[model samples]
Target chain A: MSTDTPANSESALSPEEVAELRSRVDELETELSTLRTEMDDDSKKMVIIATKGTLDMAYPPLILASTAAAFGYDVTVFHTFWGLEILHEENSKDLKLSSVGNPNLPVPNAIAALPGMDRMTTRMMRGKIEDNDVASVEELVRTSLDSGVDLQACQMTIDLLGYDEDDFYEGVTTGVGAASAFQEMVDADIQLLV
Target chain B: MSTETTETLDVKGQNCPMPVIKTKGAFDELADGETLEVVATDAGSVSDIAGWADSTDGAELLDQTEASEDGETVYKHYIRKAE
Candidate 1:
């Protein structure tokens, strides 16, 4: 008896062997595709909610949201109450410089004696933030918008405060109520009230 | 039962969201079937880290321990990587 292998012999490979090899390749391809899709989805799923406003309270939320977005999270800053003032394009100008008797303002007494305190405080805060290697509230807002983070203002507060839509900075999404804001928070993987 | 492997991430002194952000990044870098241990000094991190882990499916939190360090409370989380 002679034992020899032929190059053109299709029968050399049994039908089961061919089928198993093809199935394994198909399975591997499916798994690879699924993994790629999952990673892509994970990258897109990062979400954050930030609330900004009120003297010292204004910076944390905005800064955190912006930095989070910079780290690739889809972020949203919900500006309500005193927080809405930070969204005003002319917040440093038209807004009052006095913290005295401002119920919403944090550290109201601490800023009460500084002349032209509101403006001076804003500038000083901006400088200090820069000095600390942190982004300014305005820059953070801008960066948040640029990074595709939602910048939502509170509509009810806007109406209550008599602020027109035009008073807000560019790229801000029009006012949304608390219910809507809560819905947003619910969808977010991370939410901050600062 | 075999002993499970673990990874650690130190995010002390960082503020809110940073610890969460870094933890997420560490999770992303981990291989499937691994676990991550995160230590953070931020007060908010206790809730934030737990919330993040719970929101995602497959991820398992093995442990969460709080300890006082130099007058500040620190949170330590042990999370298993889920596919």
Candidate 2:
């Protein structure tokens, strides 16, 4: 059961045979370490910036973060400026896709600004998203957090906007300055601006 | 599909990341060299699970397949622990 019990204990191996086996072990170890290094290099780390606050913009960063995390990548999403709205506990619930300036819409700017136009447009967009099975912002964030994606709030923005830490969702790991978040992103293998 | 597994996980009706998240959790319960069988209903898991197992340091993907279950398709992935 022990390594000391040799494969052929009944007879001793010649010195040359022992030397050959030792060399073989050394070669295997080197090959294994090389493979290990290759694997390490291929493992991707993702850092994404969620800079836009609209419902349409919110889905991309959260979706990609969850997807990358599911691929066993270390993922982080940093929220700053208006993008922090997606992370806000109360505002997130009312997040809506804006139809303003959407080139795809056939309506002219004047019609687009009609009193009830925003609400109708938002409802239409929301319906399309649901019908298409696109992941909702809340669902995506849940998946991202459950997949171990770190959500960070930019402290400078939070202070400038006079928001408290508790204003964000439950899983915000850090409230850091923009520079700190960028530093983290710089070290990551993948960087995305959303 | 061809590999034998010591444990099996069913993540039916889940979407995208849940399958991989649950699979990773199952892998934690396995000892080195043991295989885990993960079954998921999410279409995205086909690539997600494979990529996760490949990129993970000590994870090995032994086998992968798809089969229909109750008129819907499901993905089955077998993984082996390496470290």
Candidate 3:
């Protein structure tokens, strides 16, 4: 009948303590597994579709894709339609901003009506973005390349539009047809049309 | 002196993951136990930096400071290299 008997018992742990200890062991096991997983490459995949050529519309997709790549995720950018223009190295340098036919573009009415409106619109847009401290489309392209974002131009669109590889910026991946692009889209975890 | 080194990257004008991406590249070039300092302008970067440091294991966020520059708020982060 000594109190030492109870204190020295093999089953000294109370039910609450046993439960808490089990929970702690589980947590430690989870943390170890998470650490191992982080060390492993099980990277995420993201796909972005760039179908518009306007400066405002161009940066978002590239920026997002590059940013995702920086975070250890594989990113692919599919350029189709007007978006393919951004990949054109030669034309990209002189790509004009168009406000006339672009409905989604935000432009002042008077400026949108000017002669050679596209050039004027481009200047206005560039100025506005600069004023707000945003990077230019060219800068975005450079960043995209530096970040290793896979840039794929639509071959069907390129041929249909009479474009050659020389027209696209450096670091662009091989031009793929529509079916390839569709396959890529289906394989991605995230699909964004920007 | 333990010879531990720390580097700082200023990406105040950069938005989104530029700060984080560039920081990752910088971290890659450092030896284990080195440190990195990152300054970012993207509002989301505050949380992103902390999250990246936590998830990367060997890395730990030592400090984070937010300051207003030219009417924009920029975040400064100090990360220790852990691996």
Top-DockQ structure, candidate number: 3
Encode model 1's per-residue lDDT on B14-38: one tens digit a residue: 6654677677767877887898989
Clashing pairs in 1: A53-A83
Q: What does candidate 3's lDDT look like per residue over B1-26, in tens digits?
A: 13233777888777665677788788
Please write out the lDDT profile of model 1 over residues A1-194, one tens digit for every residue.
44564645755788899899999999999999998986677643233333435556666666566556645667777777777887887772233334666675566676666777677656665565556444345655675676577778889889988999999888998857888878867766776666
By descending DockQ, how would the candidates be arranged?
Answer: 3, 2, 1
Work out the TM-score per prediction: 0.46, 0.71, 0.72
Candidate 3 chain A has its poorest 10 consecutive residues by lDDT at A2-11
Write the number of the candidate with greater DockQ, choosing between 2 and 3. 3
Using lDDT as the measure, name the better of candidate 1 and candidate 2.
2
Candidate 2 residue A5 Cα shift, in angstroms, is: 55
Candidate whose lDDT is highest: 2
Query: How far is B62's C-alpha from truth in model 3 (Å)?
Result: 2.7
**Model 3, residue A36: displacement in angstroms?**
16
- List chain A TM-scores, every candidate, in order: 0.60, 0.75, 0.69
lDDT of each: 0.70, 0.82, 0.78
Going through the candidates in order, what is the number of backbone clashes in each?
Answer: 1, 0, 4
Candidate 3 has which clashing residue pairs, if any? A89-A167, A89-A168, A89-A169, B58-B82
